[model samples]
Target: MKTKITDFFKLVFPSTYSEVAVFLFFIVCYGILGSYIAIHYRIIFDNRIPWDAYFSFDNKSILMTGGSFERHPLSYYFFNWVREFSLFISGGKMDVNFRLTLAWLSNIIITLNIIQVFKYLKNIIYLPLWLSLLITLFFGVFSTNIILSFTPENFTYTLFLLSLYNYYAAIKLRKEEKIPATALSLAGITIGGLTITNFVKVFIPLIFEKDLFRSWKKFGNALFRVAITMICFIVLYLNRIDFKYQNIFSKTNQQYEKFSNVKSMPTWDMIFSFFFGGNILFPGFIMSDKHNMKGFNFKGLYMDLYSSVIPYFFIAILLILISWSYIKNFKNKWVQIIIISFLIDIVIHCVMRFGLHTSYIYGGHFVFVYPLLLGWLFFTYRTSSKMMSFLTLTVAILCTYLLVNNIFRMLEFFWFMENYYQ
Candidate 1:
């Protein structure tokens, strides 16, 4: 039995268990630390962290109102609407419990969707545990969607991950010429996610590709696409965001975002932002309160303006750094797969960060690239082996610190529960 298991590991995994085992240590950090941070955001930050320093301090009253982004600020209303609708059914009974349950339920959907994305990638890409662990660690810290927790962005990110999985499923199904029932089902699942918010804005067009959309014999693909969209719309209405919320729509605002495209910055700003832009390496800067925008010249859009510069630098540096390596080992299938995945994600999300498609990974879509890059880097190259071990240790120590903080918070929650329930 031991020999058989060893053989299975050798066949399925890219490297020895040394790296993967270390990564597991980090997972303990992420789960415990991440959960605590999330609850803290709920209790202390109210609904925002990573950026709660500004906008509506409310004398530390702890509320979740408007978000940082205008496009999704409507989500603020949506969550409240959820709380209100629950009250109607509760008839004022167990009102606090109902609101708390809804809040948790929202996060549950996002977390489960992330799990599904990893599961899908595991089956299709055959990534190893070490790869997934390293990537998940990056997501836990830096990804805007994950960092922002319990918001529309988080929900949209979940759908985005699901949409990618469904996309890959469709690709396989189409190759087989007859769409599989399971693929159809998964495709249907993502449509609701997309409609709830523009989660897969960049890649939605790929779903309705010219060939796929034009072909009637490919009715399964079309049906799956349309079905999910309609279902998502229905959900939105059922959640009470139909024509009644027409006031939320804005013709002028929508037009600016869609048509009046912003130009990408020069190469220098892009490079500067990568190191200091606060997306990674230094995320606190973007969320810092010291740089108040209220009095700044570019007041309304300072965050968006500055944050957009980093990914271009990442793309340039990444390409230049990887150039010699790629040229030297062009024939390697593993290298090709890694490069393809990165490019596919970039191309699929080009519009998100102006015209520079290569930069999208540094933007709100960090989760998409974090896993793919780390997976490919750790498994494809042997250099990361030692670094991975050190990172694991670092995260474990950090997690211990985080755990003590969580105990206090958890005690606070318990105290509140006991006093309130009684």
Candidate 2:
């Protein structure tokens, strides 16, 4: 009986009991700490932000609002139910309670996503417990978008990770046997989730087709799964189709054009911004305060802008070089897929021309590159000296620490606002 149970456990979790337990502890700690910070410190930085205000809207108001179901039809219903559930749990219907409830949900999902990342790292590479925890903490701190926010990105990321895991598992299984139904179903679900949440992520499936030409039957199965998921997405999409929100894309395009005329910076600034510009590495420091356009520069509050930019620029260069070096291991399809996916994410954001100020909004989308690069490096150089590994991990932690201080500053800014509002 013990043998059977152990087998079951092994099938379920790729990591050892201790590794899983340690990551689980980290997830819980991150959730609790992150929640306290967000609830006590983080303010509603902007009211104009639609995704941030998602939970604040009641069902009646939500339906009346044109953009409520625009990008995320499925999430619209789900978050409304969450808000209703939270209201019931609190026994009082204050907006603060709703935000708190949704923030907790977001934080938990974020932490779970972090755990999934650590698990993926464990599956791909062998690292010591201390190093693993440090890397996980690095991800928790620097991946600012996942910390706590009621956005569809949270759900999308969760689905993305799950799909990637299942997809990778399927690839391995195909070496021994045919793709299993469970793997196909999981991939289909991911497709559906990505479709409903953000079509931009539709590129994910393309990353998993390394064995396509070798096996037509396997490729056919993948196509079948995608086709079915896409059909479901089309049905769900058509159900929520209203002419009312059709103008949003056109309206945003006009805003984009207007913003584009602000004059492009030097080639160096553009290059630096491409890598470090989007508040990607340090969202807290780089992001402008909600009312900054009204005359408050956050950099002035922190330090000279150059000082802030210097560290992030170097970090960006480090990540890019690390990924590039690892990509030389052309034998590893997973490395290539992740690198390509990261590049695709960067290019899409660039083409959209998210400016220095607004680029932070989509920074979360590309932060997945960090874990991918780390995983690739750890595996490709598993035989490296301890000193080399220590240095690499140190850089990752330092980058995360820089982001942490910025988060504190962000909290401080909110704390200051609290006094004014009170």
Candidate 3:
């Protein structure tokens, strides 16, 4: 048991002193940022009402340990149990500090994600130290990720789990080994348990594991494992609701339709602005005249096509580079896995238009793909000095722009929250 625990720690943690330093640096940075945001949130918003409904997050319920278990199966239990432990430690006076603790927890997860990106680049993708660090930093400062790091939502946890699973798959792929059924099932349970829809992503790696056409035994084994995972998830979910499963499908679909934005904006604009650009770039803030059930007026930061062409220009360049990289590394299995996983989000939010209006909040689900895909781009051009230098410079510039733009916009958001969100 001791050896197994040590091995698990070794597998999850930074292996080198430099990596550890990087991890700690981000921990402090995000910690301070999350603390600032949480303090402001506690001061600005009425905790009695779900003021965070604008972001589609139930901050009050989440902090108070009553997260929506219907949509997020295990989130309520997870937060409830954590809050119970915290209350016990603090002698039942943890209420004042619970929000801050949750913020720090999110920061820790975000920092771990950074470390995973760094390791995946340095070890599996084999990018240069400088370039890997740049891309990892780029991932850290994404507009949606910055919001998620401090927002106290399930999305941050989903981001961490998905990144961990992807990193595990990448390591296995690098070793030329198939992912074991047990590992896949565990991943399915955790990731799917968090957000039922993401269960599909856990199996995507399996598709790349073997050619199902010829590997009948492997296919059957994978199916059996998937069945087990699904059965376990269903049992847990049903048990949570006392096996009252009659209206589950209708209720879930209705909730999804309530959030859909098929008519809110033009499809092309939604695709370019919110789906692609808004995840990484800040857009103009829009506050609606209407109020929700809690009498809190909803607000959103959105990109407009006519507002400025600058965002679209950046989006076009990124798409072009990603396309170039995809074509160049089409034969690479890891690249394929990353892109396919990303496309899943595109299909769900962009094509299907589910929650397309607030797609930016969903960035945690797929934003990591940006850095990973860019890492593959760096790998593809590593042999060509000129191309490598050009790509490096371009990414550095993009990262710089993103960092400045996102930080400024974040401050703007805070100002808006303070003065207007009321």
Candidate 4:
């Protein structure tokens, strides 16, 4: 066992053990940082307050009582179950355990995402493991702000990634002879369940259709599996105690409309500001008009510093280059599908006028885009000259450095506000 583990490290970090050491160091640092932020930003729901209030009943009863049966019913239940487990372990009290549960889940999801991306790069572009980690660490962490906030969205988001991973695996299996029946069945369930969580996720299966649509027999098998999934969804939907078919669409539409007309920053405006909102060096958090004071109130020095470093034009040009790289690889069906899905997400958000706020944009929307950009870079220049590699490495280091500095500064400012400044 020890020999195998050592061999794995040697495989990942070839010549010296130095790179392996560095990777482990970053892993520890990020683990700590992610846990701290998630705990710090823990949100209380269902009118629960005082940080450590005890629940009124047994954990099982608490979990069964609070659920949004109208949408993502299973996920809603899952979120409550997680909270109940935390409360159970905390001896009927609500405390940091709730946030800790979420933070741990978020960290696990991020690790799984990194693993999936690494596998994709290795299989598709023959990328070395070390380079894969470097790129994944920089962009993965940069795009993970959404996981910090404890919300049902985290559960759905992690489910989405799981579904995507399974779908990717199915596609790969199909490429080699016939896909096993078990693989196809699991893929169908994951994708189908995703629809129940977020209907828009139904489109994700299409991302792999380029490889699945070669022959009628293959396509027919895929359809049969999906049919099974849809039937399962129907049964679940019908079983929900609060199920009201007529009111479902109307309720969803109303929520969408409410979000669109939020008296804060318009969806369109928030998106545009995101580019100019320090997205290159650090994550940007934009407050809306709804949260603004009636009179002038300071948004604090950290916010001012965050707002001051707007490298909009530079970042825009970099994005253009990234897009060009993907276009250059359009012949690769996977590349084409990924780029299209990402663009579809952008267009849908722009038109729907929802998910344009800082949190949503930072948290969830950029997920599709990150993989496209990261994959394109490694695929396009995997065997490039050392100078190119050097430049890429430099950019990764700079982004990591700036991101760590940004996190520390924000933490310091928040601490000061809570302790000394206030």
Candidate 5:
């Protein structure tokens, strides 16, 4: 048992000193930010109104340990267990300190995501050490990620799991090894359990693994594993809610409409500003009055084309680079996987128009793809010295701009929360 436990620990943690250093650095940075946000949240925000209008999150449900279970079936139990453990540790009292503890834990998860980004770039993508570090830093400073690192929501956990899944799949592909059914099922359960839609991403690796279209045996095996995973998820979900599944569909349908109806802008504007650009760039922050609500108002941070054209400029450059990478590396299997996973988000937010208004908050689901795809650009042009230099220079400028813009915006948000959120 001791040997097995030690092996598992090694499997999960960073093995190299450099990886450990990077992990520690992010943990401390995000930990301090999360603590500051949690302190403000406990003092200012009322527990009645949902926080979605503010930070694009349901902070009331998350803070109260009763998550939106219809959509995230397992999140309620997960947070409840954390709350219980925290209560036990605090001798049955919950206070600001308890919120701070949860925030710090979330910071660890966010840090781990940064580590995974670095690992995937260094090990699987096979980029240079300096380029990988630069891209990882770029991902770390994303406007959405700064908010996610501190917000105690399912999205933070989902980001970590998705990064882990992608990294695992990349390693398997690099090794030319078939992914075991058990591994696939486990990935399905954890990733799908958090957000049901993400379950599709877990199975995408299987498409590249084998010619399921040509082989009935492989197709049947994949179907059986998927069926088993679904059965297990249903059983666990039912058990979690004491078999009260009747109202789930109705509740979810209601929520789907409420969340998806935020089509205030034109479709193209929404796609460019919120869906793609807002995830990375810091947009104008605006607060509006909600007279119907007793003590709070709605807050939004999004791009306003009328206010500035800088966001569009950055978005244009990013899209051009990603398009170039895709066209150049269309034959690369890993590139295909990353693009497919990214397209899933585009379909959901841009095509289906689910939560289009606040699509920036969903950056955790697909923002990592930007850096990964960028890495492929470097990989593709590795032999061309001029192209490599140009790509490096372009990425550096973008990263620097993102870091400065996002950090300034984050500070503005903190000031707003401190003085005005109430």
Candidate 6:
């Protein structure tokens, strides 16, 4: 066992016993910066980290299963039970200020989960891992202005990251890596917990479609997957108590109606922004906006959060080159997994609502689907020129650095009131 632990670090770091050290370094850096900012900015002096939501205080109950029964969805009851007991033990609901503090902590958890989930991708190239982490932090944490914005949205999104990581772990397992079925099961559970989050997950089975017909024998394994999803679905349904979020959907959709192009973006905008956010690219959170007093505004050829960065898109282009070069050379199972998941991510977003702002230009959720595309590229490029590998790495690092810096400045403006400077 000790030997195996030693070997794991060797594989991750290759040269030295630095994998554990570097991982801890990243964690500590994240912890100290995030904790200090959250603590300094929190409204409550005694606000603690690891905050909890007070659902029981709201007396909320979910109605699930098409409203066919009087019982709240099982998920609703489960969470209610959790909330009640948790609050009871923790000394009860906190003030609004403390609640906001908790939201920041929740965002912190979400950020950490994303970093952990993508840790595997680091093995391919260290750059993408850093890039992915910063992207997750920028959009998922600092940019979302999410500390003040709490919802099942944050919880489900965090779970979605877990599910993605677990799915990748399952991939590692197939290669005989030291992973387990727990990752797969956990992935399903995370998906089942949130309706919108589940959308990213429906892509899972599609990856197995080609294998399904050939086996018909793996029916038991497939059934287990189905069973897990069912349990998760039950948990999500019961927790929300209402599977019908059409009203919420409808309200948010107003931005869609108002902002959606009369047609899908012109193929030019679609294809161009697909890779870059157009010519306006720099760093530093658009600091000018902070002093505007009216508020920061984003205006450019393409301003959607996901659509904002174009230079980091070499991975997408690399994937295209690989497909064109070796369509016939692809026999690996994981390659197929990458192909299918990438396509599904694209399809799900294009069909669903993707825009900017609240309806302003809100492609944040949709644009994130880029990672799987990069995964495909990474798999393809592993054997390519070291220069190409380095280029890909450079793009990813720059992409993340810019986004993270941008977000840091945005927070500075909001927190420092920089624009309204007296």
TM-scores vs. true structure, each candidate: 0.47, 0.72, 0.91, 0.71, 0.90, 0.54
- Residue 325 of model 1, lDDT score: 43
lDDT of each: 0.40, 0.49, 0.76, 0.47, 0.77, 0.39
Residue-wise lDDT of candidate 3 within 1-422, one digit each (tens)? 79968855756788788689889988888888877766665532245455344455666566565455556776766767656765565466644365567677778888887788888888889888888888888888887677777666677888888888899888877776777767877787778777777888987877777565478897887788778877877888888778888767777788778877468578888788887888888877665443546655555434443258777887788888888889999999889998888888898888888888777778878888888889999998789999998998888888888888778777777776677443
* Reference-based TM-score, model 5: 0.90
lDDT of 3 at 158: 83
Candidate no. 4 TM-score: 0.71
Best by lDDT: 5
lDDT of 6 by residue, 167-235 (tens): 454445455443333545554444433234343454354344445555665555556666665666555
Off by over 4 Å in 1: 1-31, 34-114, 138-140, 149-216, 219-249, 252-279, 284-366, 373-422
Decide which is better by TM-score, 2 or 4: 2
- Candidate order by decreasing lDDT: 5, 3, 2, 4, 1, 6
RMSD of each: 10.9, 6.2, 2.6, 7.4, 2.7, 9.3
Write one digit per residue (lDDT tens) for candidate 5, span 286-375. Answer: 766543257545554334432478778888999899889999999988889989998998888888888887787788788888888899
| Model 5 spans with C-alpha error above 4 angstroms | 1-11, 39-50, 89-91, 210-215, 241-246, 290-306
**What's each prediction's clash count?**
0, 0, 0, 0, 0, 19
Clashing pairs in 5: none
Q: Which has the better TM-score: candidate 3, or candidate 5?
A: 3
Which has the better TM-score: candidate 2, or candidate 5?
A: 5
**Which 10 residues in a row give candidate 1 its minimum summed lDDT?**
54-63
Q: Please identify model 4 stretches exceeding 4 Å from their true place.
A: 1-27, 34-71, 143-167, 170-174, 177-214, 262-269, 275-309, 358-362, 365-368, 390-394, 397-405, 416-422
lDDT of each residue in 1-422, candidate 1, tens digit only: 79957843433232335434433443444344344433433322222232323211221111234232223323444445554654565475433344344444434444444443354335434556555554444444443333323433333343444435443543444344433444343343333232223333323333434366567756666666556655554455435444545544563257336522544555434334432232332211222223233442210111222444444444344344345345544664434444454454344334243223123223443334444444444344445667656545544443343335334433543353343222
Highest TM-score: which candidate? 3
